[model samples]
Target: MRSPAAANPAPHLHLAELNSFPPPRSCLPFLVRRAETALRRRAHCHSSSRRSTQNQLHSLQIPGRISHGNPPPPPTRRVILLLLLVVVLGAMGNSIYKFLCGVCSDLSDAAFQPHGAHASVAALGRDILEFQRTKQVPEGLSRHVVSSPAAQANWYKKLQVAWKKARPAPTTPEEAGRLVVLTLKNHQKADVDGLLAFYGLPHPNEAGSAPPPAAGHHAPPAQHSAPAHKPQGVKFELHTLPVDAKAVADGDTVTVYVDTNDAPSEIKKAAAERTKARAARNYPTADALQKTIAAAGYRMVPNAKGVEVLAKKYRIRLSGIDAPESAMPYGKEATEALLKLVEGKCLTVHVYNTDRYGRSVGDLHVGGVFVQEQMLKKGFAWHYTAYDKRPELAKWQSQAQAARKGLWAASKPQEPWEYRKAKRNGNA
Candidate 1:
């Protein structure tokens, strides 16, 4: 009983001690220790809260599941990266599709375009000339050739045959003109006048006096009147041996080669100089005219090749003279005058040079008569001073002008060059 009471008394005494008004000053130490312990407990709680916050922050930075909340569906970074990759791949695929479509459109345009007929003939002529010079097929002509090697070979062989069949170099202007006509006639029919114009040759109608007096019409008797007095210094030497007239081109051009011992003589030069002096006098005296008429009996026709003394296959341009084009005023008259001089006659041709048209530029003589001088005297053509610098031709032109001959009869006559220019401008 004493022990139980004492134990109970000890509990009661401890309670009584706690309930006392104030603890001793010595107990302050224990209170301080308890306060320190409570502060330590608060610090520990604060540290744990800080650690939890740090853990939450670290989870947000990781872009994956959050530790506190429901784990984020998937990492935001991974989804964003996957979307970016898909976008990049899509852009790359779109660029490659556009480049392939452009190439196919260009090949279709080159395969078809029409080539002209007249153009083909011109091209052929150019090719022929080029081949003669270079011995190579022209690039322009090659387009007409077949693509296959065998076909091309056959085409070339045919071309060679055609070349051999064609006539040789033309000996006269008339012959040259006819050669062009015949060539076109054989290959394809074309307007003769138009073809002549195209080839830069004077039209046939403009090349001589008249269109050969039609087919069957007979020519009128020759008018043999001449200047009255003989030119004092002029000496006439007749070639007794006759040479064949190979060709006659225009009013004043012819092609003839000597078949006999009578070669081209220096007499022609002397005669030319004397003629120049005579032309300078403008009008011949009446006495001289009478003498010239008497001497006209000396006119003699020579053996010739072409029909009516006109070349069938040669090309020659009249030297020192230009006849009016058929399109020009008085052009027909000029041509008619030329025909009257040379048609049905043998001529002596003196080749001077070659023209751009591949025509022989030369002086023609009919029965020892200077054809160009006759043409000028008759007012059938201009002296073509640009090409012929002899003052004699100028004087002849002046005389014709004074006499109002041929084209000079017009109050204002247009030059052939001017007429051609007007035509080109579409102003005619």
Candidate 2:
């Protein structure tokens, strides 16, 4: 028995379910937010699809469209043109960078150099390059150039001009000499050929670079020493040359006697022959008296065909003796006697200045023998009165004339040059 409004039980069942459910107010906000969020997502998806379709159609319809993954459409002619342009620009940029770097490097180098030293750097570079090229140095060689004293001197001289042009600061000569010497010493000339090759200097070996003779080639026999002459009242004392360490100690006192009027012609001839023999032997003309000097217990430096003492403490020049190539007249004989006296003794060298021929002019005293006077006494040499105005020389010459020593034996003794002229005329 239900009323008409409640005729169906279904209506009541619905009401019962509704009554069992939670309040609609709590679910309303969530349902509305979810519906709004869903609608926005669907609209966005539809719009994106439509726009994506439109973009695809547009891209496809365009001509010559290219992408990366594929062969890339033969690199569009315009693209190739653009690439070429880029390459050119890149090259140009590289070149400009290099030029700037070079300039900056040069300026920095110029700025850092010693005030005046930079003035001639360009020329020095040129010289170094030239030397390297000529010498065929290895590619890995350091760029810095080694200098010798002589070359350094030349460099400083060149710098002087550079300074004037470049307005560089002034420098002292001593400073210049030191700089130059430092450079020169670096180029040590150890061997004869090596030295000549390095400095472009000449030597006898260079003149004859021929091959040696075959085996069993007959070489000339060695020359024998001349027999010794025991002179009257000549008290001979043997000592080592000062140059040799084993020779007598430095500063050892010695006496010398000058009796130029008493030298004999035999000794003079012997001396001249020895000189000629030495010259033929390819020996240093100056070292002709080496054995004698060394025997005297002193080391010798061969200078321009004459000998010079090479001791640290004492510097001695052989007196009255000029080697063959040094000066004319009795130079050979004088050298010979000086040698004979100095052999095997530690004698003292009284050093003097350079003679006219740039020889170390000094008196050699060995075992109490005045070597210079002995040569003069022997009539082998005339007193170099022009250079040395020793009055005793004049007296000795007169005495030599009276004694008729060596060349003094000539009734009319001619000077060496005059004799040479007469001989040349006779030959002519």
* Candidate with best TM-score: 1
Question: For each candidate, what is the lDDT?
Answer: 0.46, 0.39
For 1-428, candidate 2 gives per-residue lDDT tens digits of 73221221221133223334543666644443443344345446667454433332342222232322555446588798999999999999988997764432332334324455422233333343443335333232222223344444454344333333332322322232223233333332222122222222212212233233234422111111111343222233222232232221111112222212233444344345546666689466535554543343333332211243232223343443322222444444545544444433334345545445443445644322445665666776666554566677667777877899876776775564455466679941
* Candidate 1 Cα outliers beyond 4 Å, as residue runs: 1-313
Write down the TM-score for model 1. Answer: 0.31
Model 2 lDDT, full chain set: 0.39
For all predicted structures, in order, the TM-scores are: 0.31, 0.25
- Clashes (candidate 2): 40
- Superposing all C-alpha atoms, what RMSD in Å does each candidate have to the true structure? 26.5, 24.3
Clashes of each: 23, 40
Model 1, clash count? 23
At residue 100, candidate 2 shows an lDDT of 62
